[model samples]
Target: MRITEPYTIFLRRLPSGKSVYYYQFRDEDGKRSPAYSTGTNKIAQARRVCQRLYNEGKFKKSNEILFKTFASGFFDDESDFCKWKEVNGSSLAKSTIASYKRLLENQILPFFGSMKLKKINTDTVKRWIVWCSEKCSAKTSNNAQSVFNIIMKSAKEKKLISEVPSSELAFRKIKKKERELLTVEELNRIYHSPLWGWECARRAFLTCAITGMRIGEITGLQTFEVGDDRLNVEHTLHPKFGLGPTKTRVCRFVPIPKSLGLKRQCGKTWAFEKPTEEKPCRADYIYGKLMLICDSLGIDHKARGITVHSLRNMFISYMRGSSFGETIDLKIKAVVGHADESMTDWYTYWKPEMFPEIYEIQEKLFKEITEV
Candidate 1:
């Protein structure tokens, strides 16, 4: 039966050892529901429950009704997304999930949370792209966009939305910058700097310099991944994407100089290792240490445009100046784990200790520029 107003009355004892006391009312949909007041059996408590039910009714409705009331229902099914997150959370690393959570909470949810899934148009998605571009780098904007697209794709699969907005239409073109390289002087400064106390930082830097492996690949290397004085570039521990395949999704081995028997923790073969929980020997750690060294050397680390990746470039350059010139392609490809050999052919390779020849060429080039 429909009750027009909120009120309460105590009923005689039922089969159970309790008396029924509650206010009954029809919601906005004209469906009957009850508001219970157990202990007091009081009208005031019943009315409070009724008020709460009414407030809840304001937002609880079909997708259309929700859109009309809240301007969006995209977040209405957020619990489902939360469930998905929890499931994926277990399979992935904490940092990976954290990054995804940041994108969902800070970027995607803010824009489309309340909007009905079907109502989200390309225009709105484009606006999000513009907003991301204004606030973040192109790479970051693209990553955020990717997360949004993934959600929309899931919604489409679930029939929550008939169509997913085309994300390519919202894409912003980003210019690629040249890779930075450090000069020999800067390298020497870093090697000698006292700021780098953690031996791993120095070793990892030199490893990257000689091996040309990406930071993630270098850091993620387990003892088993190395063999015969060679580093096997196979896996990477991405900051946001978690442990997975390298960018090429291919593994290659990099030969190391036999002169250096870099060993940390006896019987451990991992090229880089740190004391458990004491500190991480990751590329970021090494990069930070390098920055500290740069600061101590009075160098503008930021303006100088040097990065850990520069070590790889130095390796490529050094290889080109060596005697084994034609072998550059195979060596660089093996060291850097390049999937495409054409890209690897860009650099010339020379012998390992041809510093004199390289300096002679450099000197001649400098003289030409100076004389002119």
Candidate 2:
């Protein structure tokens, strides 16, 4: 009945009157190994020996579990493994969990699932990478490898392995593609066009273009978060995950122009409420309107891979191209909530009133979009 990590220990006596501790271990599947003696008469000494052997990976039977069995329900939100991960302070977002599950089910599990946990080594991983390279893009192979690393680390935590085999492995290089950004002239074309309908979609697109907010951030923006000449970006609306913290999980204050006229309706909380609807505008609807506007103006949006997210690119590029020079560097990062910036608190201090230059630039941009 005595239980310890990696093994359950019990005492047994021989005919010669000497007592020794026997230990039994279980695999990831909960199948127990046969009892083996610790050859120690003292329980305290026996427990230490058991721990030492466990640390050294002497419980070979536990490592015999198949990789697929070991990874079962690992990415499932309700699984014991996932719950354990949360309790251990590594809780993942719902969207992240879903992505891990996709990688596991589609890539990692299929390659290593039949192999024993002990059999997965550097050679095996390299072979899997080779197989993945032939079957998918480098980006997908890279993601699959990352998910594989997580599983192996979890196995190491459970003492199933002494170390993660993929630790020294290198990922495939990914080719970076530049995201398309709309030009100032193009923005003017869309805004000034009488053909453009969908008032909510246009407002949201304008907000994104001016502030570099992601489509999700634009949708999640509330009336209360809007100030006289600034918007507090505290949340993002995911179609699948609904309302969540900003992508960086850090709130940012983006300077806006009062001329943009973003306001809350009497019964609406969303800054960009859809016509009579109480909910925020859908990202797809906004994207559709953008593409249509581009088509009516003879802009090849599809050829240039323009999407709603392109507005963010447009905002960053426009700010960088502006005459303000280096003074506006940190302000752009803060407005976009760049996760890697360590001076987020410092950047947040650039309030709309304090930095009239930002409003000046935004007002100029707004005038271009609204005026002929």
Candidate 3:
């Protein structure tokens, strides 16, 4: 009855003419379990069944399993991973959860769907990153890595895997080029191009420039969010998900220019009529309009040379060159809804109107530089 390493089962013939087989093994966790195979008189077949039970940790009626395998088992039990995401993704923002669902649908599930959780490893993850990088942008690749890391980390926290591969190993770096802000001349060219003719496209780009708001913030704007002589940057409309809080989760207001003719229609409503519920304007809608304008203007939409985000950068650059030079950083941060201003060394009390003087100075500098 001595059971040692490489233990074997011996079939014993009972008085009833029945044979029994036994098998045992030490798991990676150093636990042992035994099981009986079918009434095969053959030792090898019993040994094979024993090995299968041992590897799967199903030898005993009740043995705790690794979290990784447990999650995989759960995944197998249900065809849809969205249920798991919703249950486990509570900590993530709604928009983030939606994005995770998309990534899983478009990328993760397609490759790993049939595989057991225990089977996923550094090599497989790295290959997935390579594939994602080939088909997507560097930012997209990074986002996918982030989402995958979060899911795996959640799995590990719940004891799905013994350990998660180091993030350094899981994510491959894709070098991104520095983004250049658009010049005034270039901005003029882009604005004059037929692509900028759409009201939404023109309004979205101009709003970003004037208020230094992110594209999301600009696109999420509702007539209700606009106050007398000011626009609020409180929320953003995600491309895939609907309206959510701003990226920084902080709200700020930008002074509306008289040029836009924004006024209060009556006691409770602002001058800009609120969009109808049936067709509420969204960031993606604005972006689509901008893309259409670019196409009509024959601009290279895919080129890294120019982007809608450049409007915000241009606003920053222009503000920095104004009389509010010293306070430009803080002012920009305030209007742009940046959460912190440690990197920007200006007092926070400055008003957005101070940008006008800076704009005047920038105009002079621009004239001197361009001689136009």
| Winning model by lDDT | 2
Candidate 1: segments with Cα more than 4 A from true spot = 1-94, 178-180, 234-252, 263-270, 274-284, 316-334, 337-372
User: What lDDT tens digits, residue by residue, belong to model 3 across residues 1-372?
Assistant: 955554457777778888877555555455664543434678787777556545655332222443233333233222124455556743334676566667766766666655655567888787877788778887777776776676677657745565665466735566766666656665555555555433445545655666678887766677677765577667787767667878866666777564444444311332222244333345555566656666666666667455667667777777776656666565566766766654553444545566565445434433433332
Give the per-residue lDDT of model 1 (tens digit) for 83-182: 5555775333445546666777777666676677567778878887887777888877777777677667765675556777854575567787665567
TM-scores vs. true structure, each candidate:
0.59, 0.79, 0.58
**1-372, model 2: which lDDT tens digit per residue?**
955456889999888898888888765555788787776778898898778666644465655667877787678765556777779966666777888899898988888988999888999999999999998899989998999998899889877888899999999998876656678888988877665466777788788888888999888888888877778888889899988777777787888888877754312688888777788888888888788888988898877878888888888888888898678887777778886667665545665657676788889988988786
Kindly report which residue stretches of model 3 are placed more than 4 angstroms away from their true locations once superposed: 1-94, 114-124, 168-171, 177-181, 186-201, 238-241, 257-260, 264-307, 320-327, 338-372
Give the higher-lDDT candidate: 1 or 3.
Answer: 1
Cα deviation of 11, candidate 1, in Å: 38
Clashing pairs in 3: 67-159, 67-160, 68-160, 68-161, 195-293, 263-271, 322-358, 323-358
C-alpha local distance difference test of each model = 0.60, 0.80, 0.58
Q: Residue 67 deviation, candidate 3, in Å?
A: 9.0
Q: Highest TM-score: which candidate?
A: 2
Query: Per TM-score, what order, best first?
Result: 2, 1, 3
**141 in model 1: Cα distance from truth in Å?**
1.4
Question: How close to the true structure is residue 177 of candidate 1, measured as C-alpha lDDT?
Answer: 65
How many clashes does each candidate structure show, in the order listed? 10, 0, 8
